[model samples]
Target: MPPFDQTRFRLPRGARADAVLAGGVFVVVALGAEGQRLSHGEDSAPSQIASWLLIAAVCGTLLFRRRYPVTAGWFTVLGTGAYYLLSDIDGPLVIVPIVALYALAAQGRMQAAIGMAAAMIIGMAAITLAGSSDVTGTAVFMLTGWLVAVVALGSARHSRLAYAEEEARLRATEERLRIARELHDVIGHNISMINVQAGAALFRLKKDPAQAEEALGAIKASSKETLRELRATLGVLRRVDEQAPTAPAPGLARAAELVASAQLAGLPVRIERTGPERSLSAPVDLAAYRIVQESLTNAAKHSGAGQVTIRLAYGDRELALDIEDDGQGSAARPAGSGGGSGITGMTERARALGGELTAGPRPEGGFAVRARLPYGTTGKPMERSDR
Candidate 1:
């Protein structure tokens, strides 16, 4: 039975819930008024009937409390005053107005709620001073406290709900950005290789059939990898209630594959490692791999480089990456600065892991992307201070 989805049977909210609450308050106030009338035996029948009608009207205002909080708040306050004036019994009818005040404050009407609460407190104090009815000064003081508490609780509820909504929005934005980066890294790199191999195949097809066949094979491999990675990336969005993906995310372990693919795409790549090799956290590893992949893609597509070098320096607390291509000095732009998000995405990834990435043309006649990624840290990355 699907575990009986408790949310499906939870208490109502909004208008329907207000209706329920109004009905419950009406019953309680009505019973209290009737008991007081019986105990006093001084109120006339007409007055008693008028008090019941007033109670009904005041409680009915709660039905629109959520939809029209301010209007209902004022109506309930005034209606309660009328109820007291018409009826000899001081019952629990004030509860309706208190609830209305809460609704007003919860709807972000702090000014109006505070105003109405002050008016009620002052009016009660005036009545106590005038010596009308049996209500005491202490009762008025208690009512002030109740009103203050209700407004405070309502405002707190509003702030909490606002914060939760903002948090949800931020999470959604982060997820979208993550998906976009993944798609670009997975599909963009493979597609660029496919395009280059297709061009090479067409250029050699007439004169060199064997070379063209090799290029076609490279194209086929690139396409197959593209589809596989694309499917895996999209599968994450489709799986909401299913088991998490068992496949490991692409990390530094796959750097050799990237190098091989770039080589097939006619870009020579050499990887130099320094310091002892060590495992890294998943996020840091993924970021490092993606930074390398994006740098290579940019080089293959934009940089007219005959050779590229990727250096990895492992340290006790940080990993440093340096990818430099000996391409045309003026033509080498890190991650194709011509309106693509490649470099931006890579920089965001590094920064999210408490790291820094810098990409620009090197003074020594090439383009370089240098990054310093912390091993594990709780601090956020400082703002991007270097291009």
Candidate 2:
């Protein structure tokens, strides 16, 4: 048989849970009180007259334990002690205190639980050792064991809840960081091109109307691309049931458009491919595209590179991406000092997919970004089927 799926018990939480638990305990104790009444002779009606009422009081107070664990625990424990002092019966009613102790411990009230446990241990010892008492050492041992088990269960429950909450928080943090990187790459690249084109349009507005018109066209194209990419990047935040925007994510297949936009931004970029071009997974393709985009943008903005080159090489076991700029390189903008979110974002993208990216000044000149993404586990990329 298949293992049972335990996720079914991850029930919605609220006060109703407390009511259900308290009601179940109430039924068990009510039955026990009935049995106690039956055991008594006709002459002892006084002791058994209101016993069920007392059990009701104990279980009813426990309903509030989830919201006020410490307070409810004390009320129930004191009620049990009172019952023990007045009643001639034992055993069946002991579950009342055990349940309360478990609640207190599970709620993370260690001090209150410890106090109640000590009180019960002392009370049991006193009552058992008193005149003509027949309770044996094994009974005491069993009671002690039950108390320890109650505390252990509660502590384990508290620890699991805390750990699950922390795990959720960490997942949220990682998701936000990933979104931040996407936003940085999209906005930073497009806005840089837009800014450059706007400047060109302003410079040529009176001197050369044709050049000014062309610059404005580039600005329009870049603006549209920016909005589309922005929507795609932010669409992950939408509800799962909601329909996402139709804009597709940027990938290596559209890399030429990125190079064209860079050229219009006053930096000439040449893109090349080696080995047979094959289809890559969407995530790897997006990462590779963004890496090239950021490198080209950085070259235009900081390095003042007149010419940049992007190379995509497909291997039997891995895909390699190289970006090199022929600008002043480290001389114009020193390595690591050109500091911004660009390189860091690129590095994050690479590492997220178990790849490594290295970027620094070349031995001869210019800066180079080289990334190696292994694909053996995923197998060699298959050739894209043409329409």
Candidate 3:
């Protein structure tokens, strides 16, 4: 058994075509019926039979109007016109063409459909006027009804197409955002650590060979971590049908791993939890993890910083992450510094999810990164006076 698709509700094109073809046949029969009745000039059996056959053929074509709407409309119009001109049938013969015209307006090209409708109205008026009968009521009813049907159905089709296109665009946008978030979580974290350790290694290479080697080892480790993460994220971007080795990317639960890695790279990382220890929403947790990772990276880059403390606090409505490093605080740094691309990217990530991020040096001495996210309306605050 195949999975049911809720979206597949449209009438098949072929089915509509068949219906239109049937309608064209009916138009011819209907005209013949009116001709026979007029020839007899009385309520005769032969005339009645001809009219019934014609009505059946024209009505049958109604089923296929959607599939070959234009063709059916044109045929009905021609057949109806011929019937009226040859048979002297009254207003009822006009109904077939009016119906076909409406179908055309609903599904055919707008300019052409409108033109056909105009022609039908004009032809009907000429016939009625030439016959010198009071046809204003019938003409108005037929033309108005056809125009309304066309406008309504055409507008519906246009709206449906627009909605489908919008949905497709939104899905694409979401996929891109998801990929970007994953990349920031993976490569951004590793690059920060690697850049810091490499800078430290270069500084120590000539002065202290042993320290240089240690820093170099840290750089290698960070590079490997970055590469692993990059590979995993890219794999997620691959098509499902494409064969590739897949690895899961780290989420918030891997904060301990990130902290351990930072510690190994000569940065002392202290992880503190102030909120009731509980699992967080995936997005919130991912955001919290990235904030800490970025702060640790900044610590390694700016100065020979040690003792970095990361605190996670959860309140009833919001989740807060704070990263503090004992590096040169805001006072130690020059003004107009540190608002680089990395900070800009981090800010974008937080704001995209309706979160807020603030970064500055602590007054006491060191840099601080803080992010607040509204995860859900539940959770106890982790009580911490000094983190």
Candidate 4:
């Protein structure tokens, strides 16, 4: 059968014995006929015809060998036994019994294979004794070796399929865990900020009317912003299997909106842009935006500071962004208690984009958060030493 044809039948280890037995029987008859045509020996036609008929019966039984291997193999042994009894010691049909036994061993039922093998040995011995045949000892050893090879090959194929299936399952499990982690990192901080804003709105609603209205407005705005970002990040994860989303993901380009949100939250902020603004890699842009957003958020929560400075500068090999707050500066500021993973998450985001983050109290009594992200836009920022 041709390889790659899905529908083609294969001879299993049990069935292959029958195929060899059938095919060997035919070849024996053909060899006998050729011997007679060459007139090298005096062979009787009736005996030759009987031998051919015996082979046909053995070959015909092979069709049922896969279904009834025991029956087919028994019939094959019986026919070979009878042929050995009738035929004389010669070159033509001498190899048929050994070949049939091999076939039975390769493709017959286990008990049937053993029984056929025993019968083949006994029959060949009987013929050798009665007719003084040559090569009788060689046939017995060849049959035993063929059986072991077929079983080993089939078991190996089974083992390979099992291993491949197990590996695929593990890969799928690891992929799911990775997706869960990314979701937690992307959505966790934003949701917490929303909760904080909403809680403040509810607490101030009764005693301070104007302050309560402002807090409620901030909550609404924060919720809307959180929903929008969640949708975008979810969209990114969903299209990861195919293509990145057609719409560009939000990044440093949205820094103005971030500053406005901080301003609305009653944090006085000054923003300065240096060097010509240009597009950056998506990962770098996203990380820069997150660093600025989170830094501003922390300043509003922990430091009762009125003034914050955000500076963006594009350099030849890197982009530098700094968000410094002149608030009650200290390393122990409680922005969101100890449960905050925001700073850690921001650092990870920057590192993922091949950038660095530095956040600590500045020596001059303020908290300074700086991130330097490499840029490759063919031009450098205007060189000057200005603070």
Task: Specify the highest-TM-score model's number.
Answer: 1
| lDDT (10s digit) by residue, model 1, range 1-387 | 558888779898777798799999999998998889789887887987898889989999888877777888899889998888778998899999898888778878999899889988988998899997677899898999999999999999999989999999999999999999998888888898888778888989999999889889998988988887777766678865655556567898789889988887789999988776767888998999999999898888888799999999988789999999988654646354645689899999999988899988889877899999998952232233221
Candidate 3 deviant stretches above 4 angstroms? 1-136, 205-213, 241-249, 266-268, 302-307, 325-353, 360-367, 377-387
Q: How large an RMSD does model 4 have?
A: 10.8
lDDT for model 4: 0.65
Worst 10 residues of 4 by lDDT: 89-98
By summed lDDT, the worst window of 10 consecutive residues in model 3 runs over: 378-387
All candidates' TM-scores? Answer: 0.91, 0.86, 0.64, 0.49
**How accurate locally, in lDDT, is each candidate?**
0.86, 0.80, 0.67, 0.65
lDDT of 1: 0.86
Better-scoring candidate (TM-score), 2 or 4: 2
Winning model by lDDT = 1
What's the lDDT for residue 4 in model 2?
A: 80
Candidate 1 vs candidate 2: which has greater lDDT? 1
lDDT of residue 355 for candidate 4? 78
lDDT of 2 by residue, 1-387 (tens): 988898866764577777777788888887776676667633255656545566778888877877777787888878887777776655276787789898778878889998888888877787788843646667778888889889989989988998999999999999998888888888988998899889889999999999899889999999998998776665557745546666556888788888888877778888878887776787888899899988887887778787898998988877899999877766766545435577888888899888999898888778899998765355454675443
lDDT of 4 at 133: 48
Ordered list by TM-score, greatest first = 1, 2, 3, 4
Better of 3 and 4 by TM-score: 3
